[model samples]
Target: MNRIIAFLLLMTFCSCDFIEKKKVYSNDILDEELKTFNWNDVDEYPTFESCNSNLDNANKKKCFENTLRQILNDKLAKYEIIVSEEINDTVQLKITIDSQGTFVINNIVSNEVTQTEIPQLDSLLRKSLDSLPKIYPAIKRSQEVKTQFVFPVIIKIE
Candidate 1:
């Protein structure tokens, strides 16, 4: 499942322990520039969500559930097919999820110098990412405010 997240930052030389530690404080980029883009806006007050009536108890629950459902649905195939295996090799990857929820191949965070040694696994991992979708729905306040969320991906050996 994590394999599909191609934008994973890794350090092969570093232990999984380091990855765990860094997950908490290594890179600040995701914290600083991990911003959602709002291409254009109108001069007047917001009117988009005005008509989006508040979701009542049942509706609100559905609204939130639907958001997660949509994410899982979009990535289910990738989650199903792409495989990860524990090999004597490691690589780092930085994945970015756009406003639309597309996984961008940002950077390779690898402790391995040559991929030829683990070609088959490398190929399989990369192929799985093809199924990842970029459709992250922004959290709505009163119903409208799309923000960015950064999630880390780890291609664990299963």
Candidate 2:
């Protein structure tokens, strides 16, 4: 009876270790699988109607920026506001394009002077953005995904 009890105790401890090791091994496998997945790269960058002319990623990005800049500059040129002091400021725009090719302005960040002097800055930006034609959303692994863009608009008042 004593020998049999000792044998049963040993089996219980060994079985517990085996079960623990199996759980640990399973978790390690999951971690390894996740590491192998590519999470950083998108198959295609976001594109504007005018940018679609270039199939190259770098060229597409440049075209998108230039097109957006031209449109915004044209709209901003309509406003003639003189600041008290010579000032150079940057307006940060956070824009998001949804998978359905809808543009959403996430946020606009600017200096106090820009906001105070140009109270209509936000609305003006919205209007400029609204004038943009439909955009093609970014693609990740053959699936269209919502992408966010942070663009800076430089404001110089002398």
Best-fitting candidate, scored by lDDT: 2
Q: Residues 1-158, candidate 1, lDDT per residue (tens digit)?
A: 57644335444444577556434564666555445533343112111132233545455434533543444445533543333445343355444443444445555544452343344544545554565332433333233333332223333334
Q: lDDT of model 2 at residue 154?
A: 93
> Poorest 10 consecutive residues of model 2 by lDDT?
17-26
What TM-score goes with each of the models? 0.31, 0.73
What candidate 1 gets wrong by more than 4 Å, as runs, is 1-90, 113-116, 120-122, 138-158
lDDT for predicted candidate 1 compared with the true structure: 0.41
The residue-by-residue lDDT of candidate 2 on 51-76, one tens digit each, is 76546877887787888889899988
